[model samples]
Target: MQIRVADKAIDLSEGATCASVLAEGLSKKQFKNTVAAKCGETIFDLDRLIPAGCDELVPVFADTPEGLDVIRHSAAHIMAEAVKTLFPEAQVTIGPAIENGFYYDFAYKRPFTPEDLEAIEAEMERIVGRDHSFTCRLVSKDEALSLFKDMGEEYKLEIINDLGQDNYSLYSQGNFTDLCRGPHIPRTGMLKAVKLLSVAGAYWRGDEKNPMLQRIYGTAFANPKDLKTYLHRIEEAKKRDHRRLGTQLDLFSFSEEAGPGMVIWHPKGMLVRTILEDFERKEHLKRGYQIVQGPLILKRELWERSGHYENYRENMYFTEIDEQAYGIKPMNCLSHMLIYRSNIRSYRDLPQRYFELGMVHRHEKSGVLHGLSRVRAFTQDDAHIICRPDQLLEEITGVIQFVKDVAGLFGFDFELELSTRPEKSIGSDDDWERATTALTDALESVGLPYEINAGDGAFYGPKIDIKLRDALDRKWQCATVQCDFTLPERFDLHYIGQDGERHRPVMLHRVILGSVERFLGILIEHTGGAFPTWLAPTQVRILTVTDAQNDFAEACHKTLQGVGLRVEADTRNEKLGYKVREAQVEKIPYMLVIGDKEVADNVVNVRLRTGENLGTKTIDEVVDMIRNDCLEPFKRGGMSYSFF
Candidate 1:
C-alpha cells in the first residue's frame, strides 16, 4: 500500500499502525510530541491500524486543541480506571471530553466526597506511573452485552443495548475496559498533568427522571505549565463569580420561597437594569426603531400558529385563563409579528424595526438554573424587523453593525457564529438555505469572520450568534440576529411592492443584549463589579470627612443629582477612611470627599475609585468631569449622549 506523511510517499504493509508509520516518517521531535494522527478528516489513535485506500497522515501534536481533547479523554478513561480500582462496587456509565475538561459519571452506592477525590487522584497517578499501553478491540453487540453483564456494569449494559449496532469498539488500558469510539493517546503515561476539579450529582443522561450518578469533573493538558495557567484562571473565575458578587454588592438575590430561577432585584440591581433598558430605548429610537410593548401571555392558538407549540412547547410555560389556554411567551417574536401585521406597510417603508424590552419566561430545569445568567423570568432587548425580500441583506448587516456598536460600548470584543437549521425547525429547505446564506453574506460584506454552528438555530430560522469575550477572556452569548421567512409565511405577512402587488416580507428576530439578566451577569463578571460610570448603579458617593461637613456633602449630592447623576451621600458618624473604603467596596466610580477645606472653598475634593486624588474642583467642574466620563463610552461606540 502507498501512504504519504507530510510531503513524502512510502510503500507500507496494509496492517501498519499509525505509531509505526509516524516513527518512520516524522522527525524525532515531531514523533515525540505527536499524541495521535489524522488521516484525512478522521483522527486515529497511534495504535490503530492505518486504513486501506488512505494516503496521508497528519500528526496531531500535543499542544493543539484536538490533541488536548484527546489527552483529556484519555485522562477521563484513566480516572475511570482509578475509580473502578478504588471502589469495586462503582458502575461506570460514560465519560466524555468537553471544552477545557472531561467528566465521568458513575452509578455508585453514595456520592463521592472530597476525600474520595484525593484518593482517586492518587490511584490515577499510580496507574499512570505503571505506563500501560491502550489497546482497542471490536466486538459484536451480543458479545459486548454479555461481557459487561458478567462484569455487573448495568449502565454499560443498558448503553450497549440502546446502541443498536452490530459491532462496538472497546478500549482497554491495564485491567480497565470501556465502550468508546476513541482516538486516545498511546499510553496512560502520556497523561502528565491532570487535576480532578469537582464532583457533582448528574442524572444518567441529563433527564431528571433518570437515576442520579456521581460525576467527577477533571481537566488535563499537554504539560504542567498549561495546567497551572488553567487553574489560575479557574481561581480568578471563582473570585469573579456573579453570585458571590451579587450578594456582596447588594445587586440581586434568589430565594427558594420565590421559587427557583427567579431574580429578586434589590434597589441597586433594579437601578442598573433600568439604566440598561433606558439606554436601549434611546439607542433603538435613534436607529429608526419604534419602541413597542407586548402582553405577558398570548393565547395558545397564537403560539401554535407560530410553531412554538409544536417545537418549543417543552421549554414554554403554559396556563389556562377563562377556559382558554395561554402560553407565557418564551420569545418576543410572536407579538412583534402581530404588531407588524397591524399596519399595512408599503415597499417605501421597506423595513419596520420594532423594539421592545420585553420580559420572557422559559421553564428551565431546577438543576440548570444559574444566578442571573440562566433564569426562568428575564427581559430581552428584542427587536423584530419586517423588510421586503430585497432589503433582507442590508437589514441583517445593519443589525450586525448595531451589535458591534453595542459590544464596543460595553468594552467587549465579540466573535460571531452562523447557526444553521435544527432538525425540528420550521420553513422549507430552500428558505433555510436562503436565510443561512443571508447571514453569511452579511458577515462577509462587513469583513467580519464567523464560524458555522450547525443545527443550533431557532426553530423558525437560521441565526447569527454573537458571543462577547469578557475581561477574563471568557465568551458569553449575548447577541443574536435570526432571519425568519417561515414566521412571515405562517402569519401571512405582506407589504405592497413597487409592482403594486402584495409580496411576502421577511422577518428578523434579533437581540442586542439577549437577556438583560444574563448580560448583567456577564457584565458583572466582565467588569469585576467595577462598572463604568455611565452604567454604574451608583456613579458617585459623597463622603463627609466629619459631621461638620455633612451639610456640604448633602449639597454636593443634590448638585450631582440635579445633573442627572446617580449620587449618594455618606454622612454617618464614621471615619472618612472607612467611608472611602466602603464606597470603593461598592464599586462606585467616584467618591467626593467633602472636608473643611472643600466646604470653606465651596469646592469638592475628587477621589477616584482607583485611589487617585484629583485635587479640589468646583461643583460645576465636578459635574463636567462626571459627564465626560459618562459620555466617553458613547463616543467610543460612535454615538452621542447628553447628561444635562
Candidate 2:
C-alpha cells in the first residue's frame, strides 16, 4: 500500500509496523530517540501495526512538546515498575504526565521518604538498563478487573468500574502489568536522563474521603541538555520564590487567626499596593472611564437576575441580614449593571466605561490556596464598557492596545487567544456569535496571530485572554477583554438610539492587570523583589555616614521628598557601609551616601543597590537621575497615558 509521510509518498508493506518504517528510513542513532508517531492526531506506538485507514502519517519527534509528554508518561510507568519491583506488596493506582514532569500514585505501606525515592530511582535506572520492550494488549473489562482483584489492587478495580467500558487496553514491561491506554516508547533503553524529584501525599482520586496515597514526582527529556536546563530553572525559581521574598522583604503575610487566604498587608506592603492602585485609577480616567464604587453585598435576588446564583453559587459567599439573604459579590459586574440601569441612557450617553478597583470575595478551596496568587479577598483592576452595537469593535481594539501598553512597561511579551463561549454560559446563539465575531475581527484587524481556546470564556461572553510571558518564560493569564452581550439582555438594559427605538447595549468586561494582588505577586518574582524605581516602595534612601552628616542627609531627604519621590532617611550612628548594606537589603533603587567630604562639597554620592557608584552630585542631579530611571507608561503611537 501507498502511505504519505510528511508529503512524501512511499511504498509501505501491508501490516507494516512503525518499527519497520523507522529502521528502514532512518539511522540507528536517529531511531534511538524516536518514541512514537501520530496518524492523523491519533498517537500510535512504534511497535504497533499501522492502521489500515491511515493515508497520511506524521512522525512525532522526541524533542517537541507533544513528544516530551510521551517520554514523561513512559517515565511515570518506569517509576511504577521500580516501586513494584522493590516493594512487591505495593499497589500502583494512577500515574500521568503533567507540565514539565510526571508523577505516580501508589497504595503503599507508608509515605515515601527521601531514602525511598533514592532507592526507587536506582531501581528505575536498573530497569532502563535491562531494555525490556513495552507491549500492549487488549482485554475485556471482566478479565482486567479479575486480574487487578487477584493482585489486590483495589484502586485499579475502582478505576476500571468507573470507566464503564466493555474493553480496556493494558501495557506490560518485563513481569509488571498496568492498565493503560498508551502509545508509549517501544523499549526501555530509550528512557535515559530521568530523575525523581520529590514525594508528597495525595488523596486517592483527589477525594479527601478516599485513602491518601504516596505520589512520587519525576521528569524526563529528549536529551541531557534539555534536562539540565530544566533543572537549572527549578533552582532559579526557588530563589525567586515570592513567599520567601514576601516575608524577607516585609511585604505581606497570611495568618491562621484571621483566615487562610486573607492578606494582611504591612505598612510597607500597603504603600506598594497603593501605588499600583493609584496608577490604575489614573489610567482609567485618561481612557474615558468614570471611577465607580459598588456595595460589597447585594440582595440574593439581584444575583439570581445576573445568573451568578445559577452558575457561580459554589464560589460565592452568602449571608443573611434582617431575614433577607445577601451574597458577597464574587463579581463586580452585577452592581455595574445596576449603575447603567439607574437612569435612562440616550445614544449621546452611549459607550459608558465604568472602572473600579473593586474588592471581591470567593470561597476558594483551602488546598488550592497559595500566598498571594490564590486569595479569597483581592481587588481587580476591572471595568465594564457598555457601548452601542456599532462601537463594540473599537472598544475591544482599545482594550488590546491598553494591554500591550501595560505589558510593555514591565517588558512582558504576551500571546493572544480568543476564548469562545463555555458550555454552562448564559446567552442566545445569536448574541454569542455576534460577540465572538467582534473579538475575532478586532484581533484580525490588528494583524496578530492568535490561537482559539474552545469553551474557556466568561460565563456571560467570549473574551480575548492575553497570556503574558514573564522574564522566566512562564505564562500568566493577566489581561482579559471580554465581549458580554448576555448581561445587557438579561438586565434589560436599553439606550435610546437615533431611530427612536430602545436598543440593547453591548458590554465589554476587561482588566489591564487582572487581580492587583496577583499582579504584584508576579511582579515580585519576576524582578526578584527589586522593583523598578517608579513602582519601588522606596525609590531613594538617604543614608548618612555618622552623626556629623545627619543634618546634611536630612536636607537631602527633604529635597527628594519635595520632588515627589518616595524617599527616606537613615541617620543612625552607624558606619557608612552598614547603612549602605541595609539600604541594599531593602532593594532601594538609589542610595544617597552623605559623608564629611560630600557634605562639605554640597553633594551626595549615589550608590546603586547593584553596587555601582556615581561620583558626588547635587541634590537636584540625584533627584533627576532617580526620576529618569522611573517608568513612564504610555499608549501606542507616542500618546501619553495618564497615571495617578
Candidate 3:
C-alpha cells in the first residue's frame, strides 16, 4: 500500500499501518510515540490501517485550538472509562468541550473526592499507555437499546430512546463503550498533556427538576509548553479577579444580607462613578442631546403597552402600589417615548435627541451573579433619537461616530455586531425590513466591518452591538445602537410634514457604555486598576519623606489641586520608600517626593507608574507636563497612538 503524507508519497507492504508508515520512513522516534493523525479532513487513531481509498495523512500536533479540543474531549472519555472501570455502578452520560476544557457527567451514588480525581487521572494514564484503538460504529436505536440493556447500562438505553434519529453513533475503546458523536483524536495515546481541574454536581439537563449528576472537569493541551502557559494564565486571572480587587481597593461590595446581585457602591466607588457621569453629561450636551430624567417605577400597563411585558417579563420584578401592579423600570425607553408624546409637533421639531443617565433594575439568577459584570442594579447612558424618515441615515451615522469617539477616548478597539429581528418580535414585516436595511447601509457607509448576529435583536427592532477588546485580549460589549420601528407605531408617535400631513417618525434607542457599572468593571480590569492619568481617581500623590517636609508636600498638593488636578497629600509620617510603595499599590499615575534638597531648590522628585524617573523637576514644569498630556481625553496618556 502507498500513501501521501504532507508532501510525498510512500509505499508499504501488507499489514502496515499509519503508525508503521511514519515509523519506517519519517522517524522511528516520532512515529512510535505520536498522538493522532488526520487523513484529509478526517482525524483518526494512528493505529488504524490506512483505509484503501485514503489520499493524504497529516499529523495533529495538539497545539491548535481545534486539536486541543479534540484531545480534551478524548481525555473526558478516558475519564469516563476510568470511572466505569473503578466504580462499575456508575453510568456515563453526555460529555463535551467547553471554553477552557471539558467535563463529563455521570449518575453515581457518591460524590467524587480529590482522592478519586487522582485515582481516575492515574488510571487514564495507564489506559493511554495501553494504546487501545477507539473504534466508531453506527447502530440502530433498537440495537443500541438492547446492547446497553444487556450490559446493564440503563442510562445509555434512556439516551438512545430520546435521540431524534433512528440510528446513532457509539465509540468503543477496550471494554469501555459509550454513546457519542465524535470527531475525536486518533486514540487514547493522543491525550498526552492532561489535568483534572475540578468536580461538581450538575442537573441532568441543567434543570433542577431533573436528577443530579456528578461532573468531572478536566483540560488537555497538545504540548507540554502550551499546558504550562495555560496554567500560568489561569493563575494570573485568579490573582486579578475583580471580586477580590474590588474589596482590596475599597471600591465596592455586595452584601449577603441585602442580596447577592446588588452592589453597594462605597464612597470611593461613588466618586469614580460621579466623575464618569459628569464626563458623559458634558459629552452629551456637546452632541446636541437634551438630558432628561425618568421615574424609577412605572405602572404595569405602561410595560404592557411597550411590549416589554410580553418579551421581558421573566427577567422583570413586579411590585404593588395602591392596588395597582407596577414594575421597577428595566429600561428608560418607555418614559422617553411618553415624553415625546406629551405634545404633537411639526416637521421642524423632528430628530429630537433625548439623553438620560437612567438607573434600572433587573432580576438576575442567583448562580450567575458576578462582580459588576452581572448586577441587579445599574445606570445606563441611554438615549432615544426620534427623527423623520429622511434623517435616519444621518442620525445613525452621528450615533456611530459618537460611540467611536467615546470608545477611542477610553483606549478600546471595538468590534461591531449587527443583530437583526428575532423570530418572536412585534412589527410589520416591511417596517422590520426597512429598518434593518437602513442600519446595515448606515454601517456600510461609514466603512465599518461588522458581524451579523441573526435573531439576537431586541423585540422592538434590530440593533448593532459594539464589543471592545481590552488589554488582555478579552472583549466586552459596552455600546449599542438600536433601530426601533415598533416603539413609534405602538406609541402612535407622528409629526406634521411640510404639506400639513401626518408622517411617521423613526425611533432609535441607543446607549454608549451600555451600563455605567458594567463599563466601570471593564475599565478596572482593562487597566488592572491603574487607570490612565485623566480617568484615574487620584491622578497625583505628594508624599512627605518626613514630618519636616509635610509643609512642602501640602504646598505641592494645593498647587496641583488649584490647577484642577486630582491631587492628595500623604503626610502620614511614613518612610520615603513606604510612601512610594503605597502610591504604586494604589496605582496612582504620578508621585512626587519632597525633602530638604527638593524644598531648597524649589523642585520635586517625580516618578511615573511606568518606572520612568523624571528626576527633580520644577513644580511649574511638572504641572505643565500633566496639563498637556492628560487633558485632551482622546489624546490622554497617548491612547490614540495605536487606535488608528
In terms of lDDT, the best-performing candidate is 1
Rank list by TM-score:
1, 2, 3
Q: Any runs in candidate 3 off by more than 4 Å, and if so which?
A: 1-76, 79-94, 103-124, 130-182, 192-225, 636-644
TM-score for each predicted model, relative to the true structure: 0.97, 0.94, 0.82
- How many backbone clashes can be found in candidate 2? 0
Taking the tens digit of each residue's C-alpha lDDT, what string does model 3 give over 382-421?
9999999889999999989988888888788899999998
State the TM-score for model 1. 0.97
List where candidate 1 sits over 4 angstroms from the true fold. Answer: none
Task: Write the residue-wise lDDT of candidate 1 on 1-644 in tens digits.
Answer: 67898877867876798888888889999999999999888999998788766788889999999999999999999999999999999999999999899999999989999999999999999999999998999999998999999999999988888879999999999999999999899999989999999999988887778988999999999999999999999999998899999999999999999999999999999999988888889889989999999999999999999999999899999999999999999988888888888889889986999999999999987766789989999999999999987888899999999999989999999999999999888889999988888888888999988898989999999999999999878888989999998999999999998899999999999999999999999999988899999989999899887899978887788888987899988889898899999988889999888889889999988999888999999989998898999999999778887656
Better of 2 and 3 by lDDT: 2
In candidate 1, what residue range of length 10 has the lowest lDDT sum?
635-644
Q: Output the number of the TM-score-best candidate.
A: 1
How much does each candidate deviate from the true structure in C-alpha RMSD?
Answer: 1.6, 2.3, 5.6
lDDT comparing candidate 2 with the true structure: 0.87
lDDT tens per residue, model 2, 115-160: 9999999999999999999999999999999999998888899999
